[model samples]
Target: MQEWWRSAVIYQVYPRSYQDTTGNGVGDLAGITRRLDHIAALGVDCIWLSPFFASPQADMGYDISDYLSVDPLFGDMADFDALIAGAHEHGLKVIVDQVLSHTSDQHAWFKQSRSSRTNDKADWYVWADPQPDGSPPNNWPSNFGGPAWEFDPQRGQYYLQNFLAAQPDLNFHNPDVADAILETCKFWLDRGLDGFRLDTVNYYFHDQQLRSNPPSQTKQKEILTEVYGMQEHVYNKTRPENLGFLARLRALTDQYDDIMMVGEVGEEGRRSIEIMGEYTAGSARLHMAYSFAMLSDDFSAAHLRDCIEGFQTGAPDGHPYWSFSNHDVVRHVSRWGAHAVSEESMARLTCAMLMSFEGTIGIYQGEELGQTETELVYEELTDPPAIRFWPGVKGRDGCRTPMVWEKHAPNAGFSTSKPWLPVKAPQATRAVDQQGADGIMAHYKEMIAYRKSNPALSRGKTTFITLPEPLLAFTRTAEEQTLTCIFNLSADQHIVSLKTKAKVALGEAVSLEDDKLTLAGNGYAYLSHGAEVPL
Candidate 1:
């Protein structure tokens, strides 16, 4: 039987800002349990929780110190069990973020490895000796900033960290490390987790020779950071050995029934989609993978078409997951500024476009509420990237603000006390309570139900319709149904000329008219032919 994730819509929840029941200014498992009803109402098949494992908080929860246990700040094992049970009771699957590519400096394995060169766990992490001049071993730079290699005087060598220096990259070259990580994953799978969102899945391996990365002749685009992506990032990550490790992960997941794994490919440009293809090429590897290609500032129809078509060509048989927004980057509405007509229009159109794709869909929390990006001042900044490279880059804190439950409540009902990140008034206005009638939230729920009700939209084969710029048109066909989805990805009115004859279903319900299909700025319409096209 096909797995649940094949056509599922997974909602991502950033735990730190979800809801704080303990009044600790941080969201916990108990808080998540209390809010299960809200997620269930969104009609998502699964919930992808950002890292809640024990960490030093250098990179928030991404720098995991312990993978097998839950952090005290989030909750204990019992709380996790309760959350999972509540999610299941509400007919929702649970998927947690697993940072296997790296570990906190405080982790037992890393601590032991850093103590001495001859320790049993010494090779558990990527470590290399400095050159004769005491310089770092390679030209590879960390994703955060500076050199990827950090000096460890105790071992008289340098350790590699794709991210922050405090979070050291694991050496998958060591079979023991791979075994240990697999054991950690099995622990959760046995405990009833539906699956995992593999963090930095492509950064699992590095060059064995620790060679220097060659510089790219291309000019750097400072979208997120200045440290990484300045060069081609050849030898730093996406190594061939990573594929073998992914196969190992897939094998571990296969041991359990109905479990799945989605990897986060952090490569640059179209390379991310290609890596997603490679990682999920076979049944013995990742079940699905997603990249930052669609999560960028680009909102042009041509860009979207090119991205999907590129993936289709690269991984003809490989499964891919499509998402425009997540916890890592700016929200799509604000990122694509001029293209966004109104929050309501963009929210509906974005969901319509995502559901029409031929892959699994991921929707970030508060997206259903039509939440916009929250502006934060320098003093309120918590993200390291924003703090270090202020002004040039606005950082991710804008997109990581707390969820809004009640407009009148303190901290927008996220917590009684102040949140880790402030929830702005504009975001508060779009609270769940406020979206009670004819609101964006209601529209989202309706769209989700509509997609679920129509098999053609849920699990149909997609074929792109060649259209002009700012207008995206595609047809999704199943055995007995054919649905045409059209979107105007701009702030100006656009028209889609249909050369063939077809009746529009759900016309009155969704404001879509007959043969002449007219779309307002950032508008979208779902049209269906009574009969499916013969394959």
Candidate 2:
């Protein structure tokens, strides 16, 4: 098999927010097909569509109602096929998201399961009896808010819901459920899709015992989003049974040539990296797995080193997929701007740093334009988290705004009519067309090209070098190729001395003098071996 995904940079497209051709206040699959050339021009190898499956839109398209059908909001089967064919025509692979862990309350399977206990599909979704007091089965909390289990009068029991109550978790404990989902994968594979971005891959199987999660030692008072971090999450998710399920998924994908799978392991810090390792540890699992570790506010050199090293230690043979921002979180430029010289400088720096890492790369849309988080008022909110806890947790709505393509076009060129999500001035100012002359957009193209042109960056062993504060440095060594990469993680100019003679392989916004590299705030560089630092 080609293993083309090993080093390919995957670009994620949030379909409802990408582009709108229907003028129905939303983006559809046809919109994506129309913009295929834009994605190809970005130099990415693949496009990972968020979720266009038949959904009720409770959590955007994450709450799927039908595994094989595209939601009417995003177009139908014909539009999806056109997207796949068009992407391939542009030399870009297509990786659609698979939300197998759960489905919308309106799904036929869930509906059938809730109607009666004796039905053949009754056990298809996770269901349990409430305690004598009529409370939820256990202490499991939903990622959105409130109890993770919802009481259902129809079945006289509580159903498990890790996210919105509208999105019920599937009962992977059922062999029939596993078989059904696998068949769903076959449906897409038969449609000629290249790969899958497995949504909540680690959340597929919960502990059979349904143990209560213990409270964390650290109090979570930051925002509503951080409340879930207070639990140990020992049983509700990250189960061992998931490994077996992943193997089945891998085996199915192997049946098709060059097909790949990258799981989204939703965890933080150590546990996140460990799961990424375990999921991609062998040939019978995912090709790569990404965690929320890199999607956090941690920008220190030590933190970056620990995240990568943690994965390496957990599974020596495992591969990783790294990203700074996605549809689920704030844009990295805005999230990390507190320590940056400026959004433009920091955005470019993050791009270079991400490419230099020893794994595959995933870029969310609008990031290359140095886009910031849009400030949405209470009325503009659609994401569940923000709705429940307003000012405390802004939710993901700000990040899910429509992509700004034109400077003066109606609706910022995202749609001819009003967009499903509003496109505010702050975000629209960083429009794709407006940034073409200079700035982060141009830098991203250069950085991605640089990473692709150099084999060492995409397919090399990475070694982190200990340096003083604010300077993250590492070297990538592959067969007959070697390159050193350095980044300034702070908004203060600092210079560091390099022990080895380095040739300027690729650099800007920094200078070298007699082995001393001077990096302005947010500057970065890539250098090759055997050349003296410029004097």
Candidate 3:
């Protein structure tokens, strides 16, 4: 059977923002089920739901307290089953976010592990003795802030805390810990789950020696103001031992039919691509992987070419998943607005570009409406970074605001009561009900249909075509089909002389006459490269 995920497009639903049915101001599983038609209408093959598992809400639902149970805030187990059934009925595969890297401090396992050194679960978490000077074991910095270790008076030792203090990293080196995590994953798969979007997949293991990371050679900072960007991060994460656990995960998923796992590589630049290659290079590891490469602020053709070519050279056998927006980052339409004619045009351009790429695609909620980030004051912020560092950092709350379903309804129809995160005017203006036939939503549906209709665009090998600074071009070939994709990644129009005569397959603001093509700002086109034209 053909693997469903290779050519699939995934729609991500942030449960807290998708829809709220109980009027408690938070979205639930029933709300997702209620909105199944909206997702199915997009013509996507699958839906990836963000974490709705049991948690203390410390780091949202990422700090999973119980992997096996549904969070009461989202609904009960019956609600989850109904959602799964509803999605399947819509002909959409359901894949949930699996955060196995860490657990909340309130988790029963963490409580037992931290209580005493002799307990059965004592070694379940990474624990280390402080230096004789009463300091942390090493010089590792947390991804959030401060040291990566937290003091525990009861154990007289520090535990590794990769993110917030409430989240403790698990010890994957222990066989039992690995077994238990795999079993949790199996529980979900057994319940008719299509697969998982493994959160921070490269962070599963750390160096057994607990060595301090060296200073970064490239000094490539994810967040320049943060201390975590200063180190090369060879020890704390992206460890070689992570591959073993990934193989184990693959073995478990392999037991089920047509199950797929796509990992989220939490690295930057070429290193991120390299890790993506390693993690998905073989059938024994991740089926596919994605990184933050395309999610950055760099929107130039040169940057886009470099990322695609770098991945093609590094991981020829591995498959990649690409996305421009998600729960954690700024919306791409706003991030790349400087290079576009307008928000709607930019959204249409990206929809065309991402659809023509060579692997699986992920679309976040509200992206179909060309949604921009919501502006918020410090008083309305709920994200940790924004709360901790007020004016200096605008946390993820801007992107995590409630999704808008209605144009003029209260809270933009996301919830009946006040939402967990407020929905402002800018976002509410682009509600689903507001989109017309020629709007961004229609453009998305059109491009998705175009991609599915062309086999070369969906399942073909990519070859970059050299073009001018503001123009990016590539060819995708499979079997007897070939397509040339060209894009003008600037806010200025340019006309280029085509080397050969080819008819336009799908695109906007470009025509072929006397071997010439004109592309307006942010305009893109797919040209038939061979004699066999795609209908």
Candidate 4:
């Protein structure tokens, strides 16, 4: 039988900002457990919680010190079990983030590996000797800026870290390390986790020979501001050996019934979609894989079509998971504001488009509220990249602000005390309570409900329709019906010329007898053959 995640809408929750039941200013597993009803009300099939594992908090929980233990900041194992149980009770599947590509420098295995070259676990992590001149082995740059190799004088070698120096990449070449990570996954699978959201899925392996990556063939444009993207990033990530490790992960997930795994393929260019295709091509690998293709500033219809069509052609058998916003980047409403009619309209239109796509959907928390990016001052910045880059890059902390539950409550009811990131007025105004009755939240709930009610929208095959610029039109066809989805992905109004008579299905039932449909800016409409509209 097909897994639930194949046609599911997975909601992403950033644990630190999701809720704060302790009044300690930080979100914990208990806070998440208390808020499971809100998630269930959103009609999501699964909740993909960000990592809350034990970490030094250097790069947040992504730099995990212990995989088996929960960080004191986020509660203990009992809390985690409760969160899982609560989520299940609400009829929502639980998918936790797993950072298997790397571990915290504080991890016991890495500590032992860095202590001495003769240690038993010395080969557990990727370590290499410096050149004769004492220079780093390769020219690979870290994703967080500076060198990817950190000099460890104790071992007389440089350790590999694709991300922050504190988050050292594990040596997957070592079979023991791979087995150990799999065992950690089993620990959670046994505890009744639905699956995992594999972080940095492509950074699992590196060039064994430690080859230097050459310059990018494409012209160096300022558009790719992230320092890591300045280089070609060949040998540092996306190695061939990563495939076998993914296969191993798939085998482990297959041990549990109805379990699935979605990998985050972080790569530049079209390589992201290509990697997604390869990673999820067969039953031996990931169940689904998502890339940054939809997360970019490009909101053009052509671009969207290219991204979806590219994946369709590349991985005919592979499944794709699509998301526009997450904790790592700026909110889509603000990121693409120039092209949107309004933030609220954009949120509805984007969600409608996502629901219409032929793949799994991931909705980040606060998206339903039509939340925009919060303004963060220098002192309020906790994200390293934002602090290092300063005014130029506002960083991810703005997007990671605490979720607002009440408008007038302290810190908008996210915390009784100060939170990790401040909850600004703009974000607070769109709080969950305010929107619950008759706001964007209602629209989101309605949209999700509409999708669930329609078989074509939920589990249908997608086919792109020939539409002009600024209009993204597609038809989702199932055995019982065919639904046409049209979106004006621009600030300017678009006139959609229809070849046949149809009735709008979701919002309003308007007949397209004139052979032309007028769509407002950032407008979207779902059409069916009948005149009777569901709404």
Candidate 5:
């Protein structure tokens, strides 16, 4: 089989918000099956579904309770089988989210392990003795809030929880735990899964010594959205031993044909890009990996260039998957709107930039419509962190709202009844049916088609061209084609002199005259040129 993922575009489906066929106010497997055509029409090679597995709904299915079964809230086994079959029939590979780093407190394995000091699975999870004063094992803080260790009175110890207290970190230091998780992965592979979107891939292992983490040197203004960022996370996660487990997981997937895994590097800054490079450094680890580098609020040319170039320099042998939005964070259109003339223009510019990047790409649900973040109040909040932190952190529920399909239909055609997350007027106004023939959706389709048709854009090596602020330029060179991509990142128009003659292959508000290229606010140009020519 070929390495199709190297150039593939994957569409992420937040199942709970995609479509609701059950009339139960939530999206399910059958809902996804019925919506396969919608995704296929977008020309994405694969659909990466967030977790629909058996869970207590804590952390929105990330805290898996059963590795081999589906949650009743989503559907039964038959529904999943039908959804998989439907996706394949539409020429789309189906990959499900796999949360291997941790499990729900209700999982049978965690229950058994916590029941006794010496049960058969006692060491399946990371557990430690308390300090002399009954404090947590160390100073590690949970990504959500508070201490990272939860007191387990039954076991008379504290368990490591990098995220919510309900989601306990697994002990990969124990070989048995690794073997068991691998077997769980095999169960899905046997059922004909395309691959997996490994959740928190770098958190699979922790320092065995349980040493306290040192204070982060990060500037106070640059701290992340959680207390966890206050320290340099050395002992709790991203350990060196994580690579071995990734290799083993890769070995499992290699047994199946045409399978690929894309891991989520749950990190930030240059370290996030570095971890992405490390995780996907070779065929022995993840097929490709993505980081939060592009998901941040930084909208400058220097920041974007640093992210792409950082990955290239860090791991020349590794591959990357890039995205501007996902289930997490605010939508790109709203987050970067300040830098654009309009939300629609920002949407068009980001699409063009993302499609031209030299790697696999992913687009979240509703992204094609230039969807903006939902303005929600405290009463409508569902995300754990937002609920706990309140006004300090608005959380991700805004972006996880239902997909608006019909302009006038109830709940915007997402469901017959109300959705778990409200579909407000601002978001509903941008419904799929309301989009014009030449609108944002059409632009997305056009950009995706353009990327796929051009060999240089799809399968090319990237070489950045030094440019001043507000101007980003790069060349994608494939054996058959070479294209120079230039973008005006600001809301004001700019003109640049081209060094060589070129034809405009694709662009907006852009004109080529003589040797001058004029780009409007948020405009971009893809200029076709010869490899021998420099522009």
Candidate 6:
């Protein structure tokens, strides 16, 4: 039971975008409870709910005004309790998103902290005096834009905010602050919450020295709108002090029965993997961790191999959590469709590929329906990043559209009234009612069943098999079971020569000939080298 999450498939549901039950054009806990059967039908083991805590909608609930209470937009505490009980009755674990890095400016803690220098919680947040020239204490840039420091005239100092001005970073250096946050965590656990998905897990701590980070040495032809991306992020986040906090968090969670914690490592490339390893390297820290490596646009054989191998090399004792689609980035189909023959083929391919990875897996709400990103104009933008830099940077709103349950239903069955974000016609076209016998839906169910039947795919040791471009091959072994997984990541068909032994166990576009394997565009196969196929 303790290792249930190790092989569990977690389905992520964005709070506002999932389903609207109150007809208020926003998703509430009761809405999610109503959709429990839908998630259970998809064969996922658990549901990861996005932030629904009390907020001013300043980052769409990521800025927590009250960690202990659910926002009215998503219903009240009783609704949340009912949601947990509902999910539990349906044999599903509920993982809540805990945004601990910062609190909303309106939060009592922040309000009191920013009230005056002598306030009880004045040092609770990261505040510093203005430089001699009356500028920010450091040169840290916000992830949104401008300086990471916001001038608070009430306190006569600047407070660090890695994100928006409304979200002031917590000063983790204070022991009381960390203990208070953990106490809030205990409040949830005592309420029967299973675990937590720590948001911005690496941003829990900042450099106490208030040093400025140097510019990134690696230059690219393309520029990122997130100014924070241009810097190396040395001083702002991913500090060494974060480890101790994680250990404390783990200690807190260990008090509960079979509780799991997954940290979101927001760093990029191998560095993220390194942090992922460190965060989950032992039982004293995180249970597992995920990074942007698999979420980025670099979908290649080498890229996948390097990410897996990097984690294995860095922290051999660590477990990993992989997800190709979440609330943050663009949907995988929208981002990588160009490489496939069609969107459907790409969807099936990604599902098969991700399910085969030797780690816990997460699938976003509409990913099972092969949802694509919605196209929005300037007037329709809700996400701050999209509003700030239009045209050049299309922000996360495209991927956060409401889930379409019925093709003919008004607003695609998301709500009786208009939903928060407009649902695109293309996304609505793949609604659940219309997809009763749809191939992609069938494929997802079948793939999930296959993964559950085969222990090797979920709890195996992955060994990369060298092959030419676009042909990603790896062997996963567990006990006496060994399976060969192969995928053609591009639109072009490929034929590979296979020596020794293996048979196509699960998938389409897989043809076994006289020691030759043929795969069409976006094709994948799980080959069983064991005595017999388990399912």
**Clash number for each model:** 0, 0, 0, 0, 0, 0
Q: How high is the CA lDDT of each candidate model?
A: 0.85, 0.89, 0.90, 0.87, 0.91, 0.89
Question: What is the C-alpha lDDT profile of model 2 across 306-395, one tens digit per residue?
Answer: 999999899799888999999999999999999888888888889999989988999999988888998889998998889888888889
lDDT of 3 by residue, 373-427 (tens): 8889989988887788778788899888999999799999999899999989999
lDDT of 2: 0.89
- Spell out the clash pairs found in candidate 5: none
lDDT of 5 by residue, 1-535 (tens): 8988999999999999999998999999898899888889888899999999889988999999999999998889999999889998998998989999999999999999999999999999999999999999889889899998999999999999988999999999999999999999999988889999999999988888889999988875754456777788888889999999999988989889989999999888999999998998867999999999999999999999999999999879999999999999899999998999998899999999999999999999999999999989999999999999888899999999999999899999999997999999999999999888898888888889989999999999999988787999999999989999999998999888877788998899899888889899999999986511233
RMSD of 3: 2.2
Cα error, candidate 1, residue 291 (Å)? 0.4
Please give the lDDT score at residue 350 for candidate 6.
Answer: 96
Error of 4 at 466 (Å): 2.6
lDDT (10s digit) by residue, model 6, range 1-535: 5678999999999989888988988878888998899888888899999999999988999999999998999999999999999999999999999999999999999999988888789889999999999999988998788899999888889999988999999999999999999999999999999999999999988999899999888774567566666788888899999999999999998888999999999889889999999999877999999999999999899999999999999889999999998999999998998898999899999999999998899999899999888888989889987788887789899999999998888999999897889977898999988786756787898889888888788688988888888988888999968888889999998988776456788867878876678899988888876422111
Candidate that would win on lDDT: 5
Worst 10 residues of 3 by lDDT: 526-535
After TM-score superposition, the amount by which residue 125's alpha carbon in candidate 2 deviates from its true location, in angstroms, is 1.2
lDDT by residue for model 1 (228-321), tens: 6667877878989989988888888888888999999997567787888888886888899999999987888888887888888888888889
- Model 1 worst lDDT window (10 residues): 506-515
Give the poorly placed runs of model 3, Cα more than 4 Å off: 220-224, 529-535
lDDT of 1 at 54: 88
Among all windows of 10 consecutive residues in model 6, the one with the lowest summed lDDT is 526-535
Better candidate by TM-score, 1 or 4 = 4
- Model 3 compared with the native: what TM-score? 0.97
Q: Candidate 4's residue-wise lDDT over 1-535, tens digit each?
A: 6689878988999999989888889999999999999989988899999999999999889999999999999999999999888988999999999999999999999989898888889999999989999999999988777889999988889999887889999999999999999999999999999999999999999999999898787776684446666678788899999999999999988878999899999985587888899999978999999998999988888888888888998899999999999988889999999987778878878878888888899999999898999988999999988888787778899889999999999999999999989999999999988885668888878888878888898888878876677878788888998898888888776666666677777642123546677787887788889322211
TM-scores for all candidates? 0.96, 0.97, 0.97, 0.97, 0.98, 0.98
